[model samples]
Target: MAHSAFNRKESRGAHQRLDEGCTERDDVNFLKHTLAFYNPEGAPHLEYSDVKITKSAPAKRVYGGEATAQDKQNKEKANADDMKHVKMEVMRYNPETDDAPHFVTYDVPYDEQTSLLDALGYIKDNLAPDLSYRWSCRMAICGSCGMMVNRVPKLACKTFMRDYPNGVRIEALGNFPVERDLVVDMTHFIESLEAIKPYILGNDRKPSEGPNKQTPAQMAKYHQFSGCINCGLCYAACPQFGLNPEFIGPAAITLAQRYNTDSRDHGAKERMPQLNSENGVWSCTFVGYCSEVCPKHVDPAAAIQQGKAASAQDFVIAMLKPR
Candidate 1:
C-alpha cells in the first residue's frame, strides 16, 4: 500500500509525499491503476489496468479536486462570526482495508442546531467520502443512530453538538460487534427480543368479543416499561450485557416485564420460564445505567429489579404448591 501510494507523485489525500511539483489531474497518464500480484517465494509483481473512458473528456481538477474545493468552502464559511467549531473524533474501521478500529479527528462547523450526526454527515460529505455510520429519522424516534460519545451511550440525533464544549469522541455502541465504523451488529439483541415474545401472545379471540380493557392503575404498571424504542442503548449501558452477550439483556428483560405487568397481555406465564433461565433477569446487578441511558425513559433497570422479585415469589409459590 505504501509503495503504491508513494508512486502517485501527487500531494493530496493518499499521496502524502510529493517529490514532484503539484499539477492538475492528468488523465492521459494517471487514468490507469496499479495492481499487485503476490508470489510464493519471490517479490510481488506489479501490473497496471487502463481505465476506459467512454463519456465526455475528463475535466482537469485544480488544487486537488472537487473534494478539496468543497472543503475549502466549508473551512472559509466556518470562520464567520455566527459559526462555531466542533472537534469530532470519530472511530473508523473497514474489515477489508483496516486491521482494527482507529480514531480520526475532524474539525466541523457547527451552530446551535448541529448534532453529532450532523458532524458525521459533514465529515462524510466534505472531508472523507469513506466514513461509515448509521442514521435515520433525524428525530430520535427511529433509534438507528445510537453511539457512544465520550464513553457514554447516547442517541446521536438527540445529542446536540453545543452540549459538548470540549469536543466529542464517538465510537460504535458498546457490547456489540462492529459491523462497520459506528454501525453495530444487533442480531443478538434482536434474538433476545424475539426470545421473550415481545408481542401479545395467544390472543385468538374474535372481534365480536368486547375489548380486554384495563383500568388506569393497571395501565400505570407497565406504561413506563412500554416506552422502550428498542434503541439498544440500555444493552450498551449494561455492564453485565457487555460481559455476557448470551444474556437476554436489559431491553429484552424490561420488555418481558412490560408485557408481564400488562392487563391485556397474558404471556407472563409463558415468559417466566425464559426469565428464570441462567441467562435471564438474574444477570442484572441493578447498575441503573440502563435506565440512565434510556432515550424514552424506559427504566429497564427498574423492570429487571421487579422481575427478580417476581421470579422469587413465583419460585416460592411453586415450591409450596401441592404437586
Candidate 2:
C-alpha cells in the first residue's frame, strides 16, 4: 500500500504530491483500485481493477455560473412534478415531554436545489416549531449542522436534497449522547479539543519580539490539518471512539499533529503524553472512515498513524538512552 501510494504521482483529494505539483485529476491511470499482492522475499506484485461507475460519469466541475430564469423554472417544475413530497424521518427528543427519542415523520415540499438544512428549516418554520437542532451560518464553515444523514456524517448545509431524491433519515451524530432532537452533546469533543491545545505555543516569544514568520514550506506541513472546523463528524465516523469513549478521537489528535508539525510550535513535548497514552494514538485501528467523512478533508487517520510512528520512535529512544 505504501509503495502504491508513493508511486501514484498525481494529486487527488487529500493526497497531494509536492513533486508533481499538478492539481488536475488523472483519471486515466488512477481511476481504479490498486491491488497489491504480498511477497515474502521480493517486491509486491501490483494490479489495477476498474472502478464501478454506477450512477454518473466522471466530469470536471465548472464553477461560478448562475442558471437562467427559464432553466430555473424548468428545473423547479420538474422537481415539483417528480417529487411532490419528501418523507423526512427526523429524530425527535425532549427531556420534558418525551422519555425516549423517536423518529417524527414530516412530508415536506421538495425542491431540486434545496439543501437538507433548508428542508429542516422548512419543517421548523411551518410544520414543527418545537423541533430542535443546532444550526448557524447556514454555510459549511461553522460545522454546527453536522448530523447523520442516511447514516453518514455530513454537513446538512452542504448536502443537497436532490442527491437523496427518494428520502433520507436524519439523526444526531454517532458516538455521542443525544442532547435533544438532532443535537448531540459536544462537551466531550470540546474537552478533547482543549486537551490537545490546538494553538501555536511559540518559543516563549512575545508579540514585541518581531513577527513569528513562516515560509510556504513551513506552512505546508500543517496547513491541511489546520482546516479542521471541529465538526465532530470525524468522531461520529471513528469506530475507536465508538468502542472507547475515553479514546482521544481523530479530530483532537489531528489538531495535536497539526501543532506538532508546525515549525513555530514548541509544545509537542507537552502534548506527547496524551499522544503516547493508551487511549491516544495506540487506540486507533485506522479504519480511515474519519478521513472519508471529514468535510474539511483534515485526514485525521493519517495524522494518528504518523503520530504512532513518531511516538514509537520517541519511546525506543527514551528506553535506549534511559531518559
Candidate 3:
C-alpha cells in the first residue's frame, strides 16, 4: 500500500496537514483516511475534505486518528468478552509411579462448538506434556474415545465442553481396569466379544447355497443390533458388569443376538451355551443403563431380554423332545 500510494503522507517531503486528528502512526487505518492526490508539477497534496464526505450519509467531520484508535480498542475488548473458559478435571494415573489414580484440573477456554475431547487435547498440548488419553476417528466412528464424563459413559469427541456449564469430571470407562489415564484395558472386553462367536455359523455348504437370501423386513429384525460400533459405553454404564465382571456384558450379549436374530445365521445354538450360563444374559438384572449409554443406540438391554426368551424356548424344546 505504501509503495503504490500517490505519495503516503507519512513519507512525503513537504506535505501540508489540512486534516485534523491525524496521529503519528496508523493515521491512515488502511484506506480510511482522506486520500492524497497529485497537484500540478507532481507535488502530492492532502485533499481538504470532511471524513464524512466519503460516508454513506454526509453530516459530521470527525478525528480520523482518534476514531481509528478507539475502534481498535473496542474490537479488542469485544473479542475478549466473547470467549468463556471452563475447568477440565481430568483423571491421571501411572501404575508404576502412583499407588492410585488422581485428578488434575486445567483452565481451558471454550465456545459452544468446543468439545470435551478438544479441551483434553488443549490441556495435553499446552499445559501438561505427560497427559495421556485415547482418541481416533474424532467423528465418533472408531469408538476409541470412550470415557466416563461426569460419571456417565460417553465418547469425548461427541461430548461437548459447553454442555457442562458447571465444568466436567472425566474418568476411564467403568467396569474395566484403567491402563493409563483415560484408556481402560479392553482385554476382557475383546475376549467377551470373541466368546460370543459373533459371526454367522456355516451350514456346511459345498460351493455356495445361492448366498442365503433375505428381504429388507428380515434384515430389519436385527438391523438395530448390527449398528454396534463396540464403543463399550454400555459396559461402562452396566451396574451388572460392575457387580460381576464375569458377566458376558451387554455388548457381547447384544452381538450374540445380532447374529441370533439374523436370517442368514445358524450360530444361535453355539452362542446359546454362553448366553444361558450363570454369567451370560442371566446376569443382567435389566437395569437398562447399558441401553441408555450406548453411543450407537444398540439396545443391549433389549437384546438380553430377547436372549432370555430364546433360552427359555430352548429349555422347553429340550423338555418336550427326549434326547
Candidate 4:
C-alpha cells in the first residue's frame, strides 16, 4: 500500500511523490490522492530518460560520453548489456486439465523499453503456447488487456516492466470469477451495464419526426462521460462493487450519466430512480478508485457523485411543490 499524503497546494492532476518507505512501515496516517497521467513523461523523471542538465556555476555541458552522439549511444548500449533479466511468476489455470490454479514462473528478458505485454507475448511465442489471456487492440484502446500485475490493476500496454525488474507476479483482474489463466468472467459486469439501460432513450416521437435539438453546452456537459470502454478495471478497483454485485459499478453509472445529462434526452426524470436506488448511486462511498483506474479519463466517480446530487435535488424539489 504505497501512498503519499495529500497536498492541497498542488492541483488535483499534478504529480506528487509517493513516500513508499514511510507508507510500508505504517508510521503516519496520510490521505492518499490518486491522479491520472496520460504518458510516461508524467511519471518520475528517472523512470524514462535519465539524462538531465543541471546548472552549477554557468551551466556547464556535462556528458557521460564524448561530444559525438554515437559515442553516448554506444555507452547506453553497453549499460543495457550489463543489465540482468528477471523471472515473472504468472498464475496458471486450466479448467479442462488442471484441477486448481498455480503460479508458473517464466524468466523473461528484461529491458527499459519492454512492457508487461511484451513479456507475455514472449512467453506465448517462445516459452508457452498454451498460456491463456484476453487481449485486443494492444494500444490500450480496446481495454481488453487489463490485469493485475504485481497486485496492481493496470493496462499491459501502458505499464512498463523497467519499474519492476526484480521478480514480478501477474494474475487475473480482481473481484471477478477466474475463467482461466489471466482471464476472468466478465458476464457480471456486462449484465450490470445492461441493467442500467446504457443506451439513450431519445425517442419522444415517431421515426418521421424532426431531429432532437441540443445545445452545444449540453453536449459538452456529458462529453467527458462518454469515453468509457468498459475495461472492468474500475470494477476491480472498487470496493463497493466487491461488497455488492448490483451496485451498477462505474462504467454503467457513467453511461447513465451520459444519457441523463444530455439535453436531447427526455428520460432524466425516468432514469433518476435507477441512478439513485438502494443498489445504485447510494451504494458508492465515493471511493474514487473508479476514476483512478479509468483508462479513458471518464471520471465515473464524478458522474456518480453528480447523480447523487441530482437525485437529492429532485427529491427536494418534489417535496417543496404544493399538492
Name the candidate that leads on lDDT.
Answer: 2
lDDT, residue 40, candidate 3 = 65
Which pairs clash in the backbone of model 4? none
lDDT (Cα, 0-100) at 260 in candidate 3: 93
Give lDDT tens digits, candidate 4, residues 1-323: 21243334333222334543322432122232333334545542111122344666876777666367566456655654676677999999999988988999997776888889978986886679899888888888898988998887888888888888778999999888899999999998888787767766756666678776778888999999988888888988999988987777888888888988877677777677777788878899998987987778889999999988888898899899999
The clash tally of candidate 4 reads: 0
Give candidate 1 regions above 4 Å deviation: 1-82
Off by over 4 Å in 3: 1-82, 204-211
TM-scores, one per candidate: 0.74, 0.73, 0.73, 0.68
Candidate 3 local lDDT, 22-131, one digit each (tens): 44444334334445666767766665332333446666876756577457656545653677988778999998798999998888777888788878876775678788
Highest-TM-score candidate:
1
Instruction: At residue 245, give the lDDT of candidate 3.
Output: 90
Output the better candidate (2/4) by lDDT.
2
- lDDT (Cα atoms) of all candidates against the true structure: 0.84, 0.85, 0.83, 0.78
Q: Which scores greater on TM-score, model 1 or model 2?
A: 1
Q: Give the TM-score of candidate 4.
A: 0.68
lDDT of 2 at 197: 88
Candidate 1 residues 21-50, lDDT tens each?
A: 535555555666775555665665666767
Model 2 per-residue lDDT tens digits across residues 1-323:
33656445332333555466746655656566775665676676666777776787689775557556567557655655776578899999997888998998898777677889988987886679888888898888999999999899999999988887688899999999998899889998999899988887857888999998999999998888898989999999988899999998999999999999999999998888989998889999989999999998788988998899889987888789954
Taking all chains together, the TM-score of candidate 1 against the true structure is 0.74
Q: Model 4 segments beyond 4 Å from truth?
A: 1-84, 97-99, 204-214, 317-323
